[model samples]
Every structure is written in structure tokens, then in C-alpha cells.
Target: MENNRVKKQPPKKNLWKPEEDLILKKYVEAHGEGNWATVSQKSGLKRGGKSCRLRWKNYLRPNIKRGRMSQEEEDLIIRMHKLLGNRWSLIAGRLPGRTDNEVKNYWNTHLNKISPLGKRKHVDSNDQNNTNSTETTNKKSKIHTYPVISIDAQKNPTKESNGKKEEGSTSLLNPLMTDTKSFSYDTESPFIATNTSTFFFDDEPLITYMDSFALFEGFGYTTGENYAELGMQLVSP
Candidate 1:
């Protein structure tokens, strides 16, 4: 007595070539689609029916989109994904010139970063926590090291006579400043740089800086508390 068992063969998975593609395309065009079983035997291709179907449907389709997905397409995919929940075939059917596999692949690789659906709330919470921590740290590390300045713009320093003014002095504080325009006072400008080399008051060089509007640096008008700390006096003519 002789007993025998037959082993089932696995499906063909040979890579498709250009000539094979041409042959398959022509055959499909001639005979029409929807019959993948006899594609290998009838069309003389070494690839299995499943492989032929995939190649034609996914890549070789005439109306398929070839370039990168447009913003409109991406938005649509996201919307559809939210509604349909990974039903790629249904989603692809809604979009013109797009295939199921292409949509599936795009969603798997690209859609996760942008999709609003299935997003966790913990991410936002973590961001808020970090922001609060940063704010607290900044408040703790704050310092008040701003420079103090006093402004008293006397037109003629010789009359006030704070410094010694010798008679017939070549470069004296008689007129105080030669380049009055260098002082360039304007309420609109932040600060004015002045050339104070016009005098050596009692044989000492004097440099002047004035931004009387807010003469102090780091005096940002950010808070009501900061505004309250500021003071100024108006001079009468």
C-alpha cells in the first residue's frame, strides 16, 4: 500500500517589469477589468493576480494622482479620517484620482502629525505646566539694578554758575553747550545723544546724556506698579 500527501504551493511573488506592465495594461484595456484570477496565465506575466491587480490599481491607473498631495487633499483626508476612522477605501472613493492603498499609506505616514482627532489633552496640560514653571522662575530671579538719572536743563550754565567760570575763558561754560542741536530734545524720540566737548568746566571734561521722557533704562511701561514707582517734576520759566 502506498500513501501520499500533496503540499499546497504559496502564491507567486516575482517582481514585475516594464514589458510585463505593458503586456498587463494592454490585456486589461482589451479584455476590461474585474477578473484578476486568470491575469497571470492569460496575460503571460510571471506575477500573481493579486500583485498585478495591486500594481495596476495603485500605481499604473491612468487617472491616479502622481505628485505630492495638495493642501485641499490633505484637509479632506483628515476630515474623512475623523469621520470614517481608517476606512481608506471609502475615503479614497470620495476623493477623485486617489486610490485606497495611496490614501492608506499617506494616513499611516503623514496624517498623524496634523490630525485633530484622537489627540490627547495631556500635551496641552504639559505645555501649560512648563509655561507656569518658567513664569515662576522668572519672577523669583527678577532684580532691580536700573541706573538712576536726574535732569535739570538750565539753558545758560554761566548764570547759575555751578562750576568756576574764569573771565575771558576760551572754552568755558558761558554758553554751556555749543551744539544745542546735538542735545536734539524731542518728546517723540526715545533718547538723544549730545556732544558735550564744548566745555572743560574748571579744567574737567563733562559728558551729558538725556532722555527726559523716561531717562532711566529698563523702565518698561509694562505694569501699573512700575508706573507708580516713576516720578518727574516740571520746571517753570
Candidate 2:
């Protein structure tokens, strides 16, 4: 620095003007859009190729659906947000004539506050209140006791000729004593009945349909091995 060596200054960024835009558009129209660096050089614009390309794509692109989003578009954006979550590029890809920048801006301005996560919190709070009320009611109500008949396998245990207990000697609950209905896998007895049609592969529709039935109260079903041991509480409403 003491030797008086002058430092090289960076070139100033080109401030885009209407004339430059016209030149870029004219060049693109003539060549039908290929090689942006070549286009920038040929267009005689001071801006870089990337900057020109971005300006053209985001602003000057033809058939871009501008103005306020429709109700259908808003609903689609909400659903896509739930599935994709802030992946604006991917979301924009699904929405025709919409840009990632537009989607991101819209989400930031509007959808962030009334998102599904916020709605879920409201629903959960309401459910908690309902549960508290139900608990209070249950505490005040008279509790009725039911007899539990436990059929022990050891009482009349199945044994081999050597006096060892057989492998199949497992305790079973007496069907007559309990309020619950037992369905055999071999039989075609319907455990759940619904008028609504449900796809065989999709469990959601079937579960939703069954949830409407008031016969089974305070019971939940899980997937895999836990599903086999579904407990039904006989609650008289």
C-alpha cells in the first residue's frame, strides 16, 4: 500500500432501462432464445447473461397469469403447501403460469398465518376442552360394574402323554360373559358396517367411515400387530 499501487475497482452493475429491455427482447425474438452469454453480447446490453435471463423469465415471459389468485388457485396452494412445505419452485411447477417468486411472496403475505398447522392447533384446543367437559360428566355419572369371567387354561389344561402342558394351551376369554363380539377369520362376519364406499387399498376412508358410527365409543385402531388386539369399550350413550 505504501508503494502507491492503485487497486482495481469492480465494474458498476448495469441499471436496466426500457431501451435495454427492448434490445434484449429483439435479440431473443431474432434468435429464438439459446446461449444467454451470446445473447447478452449480441443484444449490446451492459447487464450479465443471468440477469437478462432472470428479468425476461420472471417479468417479460408471455402468457403469465397475472393479478389476484382465484379461490381454486388459493385452495390448490394451501394443499400443495401441506404436501410440499415452502418448496416454492416445486409448488410453482404444479401451478401453471405462476412463478416461484410469486408463490413465495403470496405464502409470506397471506397463507402463513392461517396455515393447516394453525388450524390443527385450534382443533386440538377445542378437543381438549371437550375432553375436560366429558371427564367432569363421567365423574358425576354413576359407574356400573360388569362381571369379568376369566377362563384359565391351567384349570383344564391340555397336556401331552408325558404330563407336559401342550403348546396350544393358551387362556381364552369366554365370549358369552363379555359384551364384546368375536369374529373368526374363517367366517365372513362383518366387524364394521358402512354405507359409504371405500377403496380396499386406502385405510383412511374405511377408518373415517367407521369413526362416524356411535356404537363403538372411545376406541382407536392402529396399524400392524397392534390392530389385531383392538379393544372396544361398551359405552352406553
Candidate 3:
């Protein structure tokens, strides 16, 4: 059996007037955009409902975060794409207020600018040790400062007696570490993986915060010196 599914295309002259925008926005909000034919008929736009839907999604959504991605953001998308492949929707989740289309377009456009050396390195194959790329030195400096926050409880050992820390408790101190070489997790620090080459922490809170975690282990540490013992027990196995 032959299957025929025609691809939809945006109109050649895709100029959107204020009145048309209002009508489409109103209709989409009132009834949503599933049946495009009905949307065109009811919304009274000169263009197809699919066009309206595309415009609304690709541009007019209230949550859409417009503007060129900062260098750090560009690096993040590159890094995440390596981990997620073409799963733009999943990548979009990490970047609030940005659509998958925006990420996709940005990835397509700016990616070439970042990698002018002519090869599109598969994100998965990129070596973490090789920080040098086609990107400018200024952009590279921005990437070095981007914060990587994770919720994994194993890497960061808490000295507090509580077994689990709530979400939103960690601060973004540095870019999240990734590498082509796989590594195992062996630690008591909920924030640090065993093979991590560098550790960044907020000096003011880490001691007290880790102490609070010690309470979870049925330990009563009366002094800061005891944290080593707690850390040893937490990572003993």
C-alpha cells in the first residue's frame, strides 16, 4: 500500500498583521489549534490555520524567550545536545521559556558559527579534555563560568542526619562536568561525582549544610573535625 501524507508549508508572504494576530491568538486560546481548517474558517485569517499555529508556536507564545543565546547558553545547548541527541523537547525542558524550535534553529544557525572549522562534532563524541574549539576565546571564557547544578545525592555527602535533601537546595557554582570517558559514582557528597576533576562549593554554607546532612546518618558531630569520619563512613563501601 502507498501512503500519501502531504507536508505542510508556511505561506510565502508570512507577514502577520496586528488584527490577524489578535484573531488567531483569540481563536487558538478559545478552542486550541488541532483542526486547522476549522481554525481558518472560524478565526477568519487569510492564511491556513496551520500557518497560524506555526506563527503562534514559533513566535507569539507568551513564554517564548526571544533573543540570541548568550555564549554560555550556546555552550549549554551544545553540551545537552550531546547527551540528548535530537530530543529538542527534552532539551527545551532544561531551558525554561525557550521553545524546541528556537533551540533547533539556534542550534542549526549559530552552531556553524561556533564550529567554523568545518566538522560538526557529534555532541556524544566531544572530548571534555579538549576545551579548544572553533569558538572564540571570549565565548570559551563564558563557558568556563556557567554553573552546573545537579541533584544527585550520592556524589555529595551530607553530614546532617537527614537522608535526603530537598530540591532547590543547591547553588549553581560551576558548569556541570561531562566527559567522553565513563566514570563510576563513589562518594558521600551529594553534589560531587567520584571522577570529578574539580569541586566548587559556596564556602559559607557547605560546612553547615553538610553538617545538617550528617544528622541523617544517626551521627551527632559536635565539631567540624568529625566530618572526615562521617565522609569516610559515607563512602566506605
lDDT of 1 by residue, 100-138 (tens): 888877876687545443232333543443331111224
Query: What is candidate 2's local distance difference test score?
Result: 0.46
When 2 and 3 are scored with lDDT, the better candidate is 3
Per-residue lDDT of 202 in model 1: 21
Candidates' C-alpha lDDT:
0.48, 0.46, 0.48
Go through the candidates in order and give the clash count of each.
0, 0, 24
| lDDT for predicted candidate 3 compared with the true structure | 0.48
Each prediction's TM-score versus the true structure? 0.43, 0.42, 0.43
> Which residue ranges in model 2 land beyond 4 Å of their true spot?
1-15, 116-237
Candidate 2, residues 1-237: lDDT per residue as tens digits? Answer: 575666776667556778888888887778866588777777788778888887677666675778887775676666555433554655565455777888877876777657434332233543543331112224333232222323333222222355353222212243343433222121111222112121111112222222212112222222223222222122221
lDDT by residue for model 3 (42-112), tens: 76788876787788877776767888777656765775554334545544544656678888778766774
Better of 2 and 3 by TM-score: 3
After superposition, the stretches of candidate 1 with alpha carbons farther than 4 Å from their true spots are 1-14, 115-237
